[model samples]
Structures are given as C-alpha cells and as structure tokens.
Target: MVTTKLEIHGRVGVIFHAILEHRHYSADQPPESLFQFIDYSNKCLETVKRSVEEYCAAKERQGFFIEQDNLSMFYETLCVGYDWNENLEDHSPTAFAESSQPPLPLPLIQQQQPQPEESEGGKPPKINLSQQRERAAKLKYKDLADYFDYPIQEAARLLNLCPTVLKKICRQEGVPRWPHRKVKSLKKQMDKVKDFMSSNVCTVEESASLQESLNKLQRDLDITVAGGKIAE
Candidate 1:
C-alpha cells in the first residue's frame, strides 16, 4: 500500500482542521455516504496544500507535515481519542487534534483599492439574523423549560450551560417554573420522528421522500432565521 505525504502549515493547517471538523458526520454514516465527504475533504486538503506551500515559500519557514490517506484513519483515531462512542454524533475534529504550532503573526492582506463611493459587492439577505436566533432560542427555551421542567436544573446538564446560568435565564425571561401543556404531545411527535430516522425502510421511494422532506425542512428552518445579513 502506498500513501502520499503533504506538508501543511499555520493557516493551511488551520484550514484542514476546519474542514475535518465540519466534513465527517455520524459513526452510522453508511459507506455510500463517504464518497461526497471524501471528495470534499480531498478538495479542501488540496487547496490548503497549495495555499500553505506558497505561504511558507514566502515566509521561508518549514511547514507542518501530514500523512495523506483515506482520512478515515485519521477520523477513526479522532473518534477513539475524543470519546465519540454512543450517539455517534458530530463533533469538531479539532477538539482532538489541536494545532501544533504557537500563534504566529498573521500575514498582511493586500487588497486592490476600489473606486470611491462604489457600491458594496452584493446586496445583503433580507432576513434578520437576531430574529432567526430568537426564533430558535424560543424553541430551545421551551424544550429546556417544559421537557426538562422548571429551574431547568437537570435539563441544564444536557446542555453546555451551568444550572445557575440557566436558572438566571429562566428568571430573567420570566418563564414559568412548570412544563408546558404540549410537552407530552411534542415528546410523542419527536419519538416518532426519531424512530423513523433510525429505521431502514429499504424502498427507494421511501428514501427519496424522506430526503426530500428533510431538505425542504432544513431550507425552511434556514430561511426562518431572523437576520438582515445573509449567509456569506
């Protein structure tokens, strides 16, 4: 078996790490799902390789070295090292493999001067980001408040926030200390969805339908975010 050697450095290393963090999905991701991920990961690594080569050439410093392989090897290492057993969830690969180098001075970015009073490159998105976040937050607040119950103590354990912080939020938001009336119904609905997602229906039509629904729902939720500034 043969493998390639690629030397990445500084910003390029950072870029590769970012791509790694974002690309891999769940442990249950099927073999068929890997083609696209591998393609994207390779493209990103290639771009970073080129960019780092040029940058390091200009800077005259020895860059970082990385072994180029199927990426699954690296990902497997990360999964075992990072404790991604059950849930097989998406987590940043960077958390397991941090940058080896200390922070260096960034290169100065040189940009072409634009004509005075020229319009910005593109029109902004009409949606409001803050509004979108508020919308999402409202859903989360309800989930934390009702599903987990008030003071949000036990529920806070499920999230990154401290119990005290969540309690503060509950108080500040004037959220009641009792579960919402919809909790039982919501739980049933969510359970059904989870079961469906975990099932292997094996029919092409069913798979296509599920994919279509998921895509449409994701688009809807993306558009629902409240922000004037659009995604870049």
Candidate 2:
C-alpha cells in the first residue's frame, strides 16, 4: 500500500534535493542503485510540479493571490525526514523522535476535493487536446488491472500492452498515474469511474451501476475468501 505520509515526504525531499543539487544526478550511483533513485526522484518531482501548477491556476481563476507561504509550509511538511544534504541540519527533532517511536498507523491520505467550477464572470479554462493526449498516455496498467479482473502482469498480457502504454493511456485520460505506491484510494477509484463515464466506454448510469457491481464483487470475495462476515 502506498503511504501518503511517505510519498509526500519523499516528493518534498526529492524536490529539495534537486534544488540543492542544481545539477540532476545521473542514473549511476553507488551502494543502493543510484540510477533507480534518480529516475524515481525525477518522476516524483514531475508530479509535484503538476500539482503546484494546478493549484496556482485554480487560485488565479478565483482572482486570489497564490499563497506562497502556505505552499512553502506544505513543501516543508512533505520534506519531513528527507535527508537533503543542506536541510539535513535543520531536520525537525520532533520528526526524528517520531521516527524512533513505533511507527504510528496512519489513515490513507484523502484526495483533494475537486475545485468548484469557474464563476460565470471568469474566463473559461481551455483544454489542449495535444496535452490531454500526452497526459492520458501515462496511465498505469496496475490501476486498470482490477477493471479486467487480472493481476497487473496478467492484465498487461491480456491487453497485449506494455506497462508504459497503460501509463500513457492513463495520462491521456487525465488520471493520476504517478506515486502509485499504494492501492488506488477511493477518490482515485471514483476518478477512474468518472473517466469511463466521460469516455465512450460507458454511459453515466452504466458507469454508476458498474461501480456498484464492482463493489459487490469485492464484498462477496471478502466474505467467501477472507472469511469476512456480511453485515445485515
């Protein structure tokens, strides 16, 4: 399962580290595979960048000043425990202390609520088809795996698709495909459902019913395979 606590922290750390390094690290390092670390870090940075841009755009649409202080605070919180060489000295003692304690169980991070539609007086946001296609192309196969009732690997095979293809499709569809370090949260699940609703894949009512069907399938599986009891 992806822990937002860890992911958010990791992303902040990577961004801070990138800023500190100025020069991007190559795919080669020592001890623990530097290439993988650099690759993952770059991906995390991209996700953060997109999120910040979106937030800024939304605020602008509302005729509000983007709160730089809040952004900085959020960045700091996410970077907690990140060993950015420069920030290492300023690491919060409290965070270190918390690290020593048995890790507290944390609830999943909820997705941010969708912003309200732009006011009638505001200019409408324009959609770029080229950018949309590029984004849609990045969806992960694993995210769509359950929709096909297959493990990620098997789903990839059945679809005759590479993981990269699945990821790209997700991006084109405007679905979040990164930092997929956890099972899809409920909000993400709904987002996927919404995507299907918008596409020619299903009608709105069919999409809703399909979601309920999937939920029922999950409940039945839990009861039969996991020995979970059905509540009245």
RMSD of each: 19.3, 19.0
Give one digit per residue, the lDDT tens place, for model 1 in 123-146: 432323235434444443334533
The TM-score, computed over Cα atoms with residue i paired to residue i, of candidate 2 is 0.18
Compute each candidate's TM-score over C-alphas: 0.19, 0.18
True lDDT of residue 1, candidate 1: 10
Per-prediction count of colliding residue pairs? 10, 22
| Candidate 2 C-alpha lDDT tens digits along 143-201 | 45354343433444444343334444444445434222333343356567566767886
Among all windows of ten consecutive residues in candidate 1, which has the lowest summed lDDT? 30-39
Give the per-residue Cα lDDT of candidate 1 at 224: 27
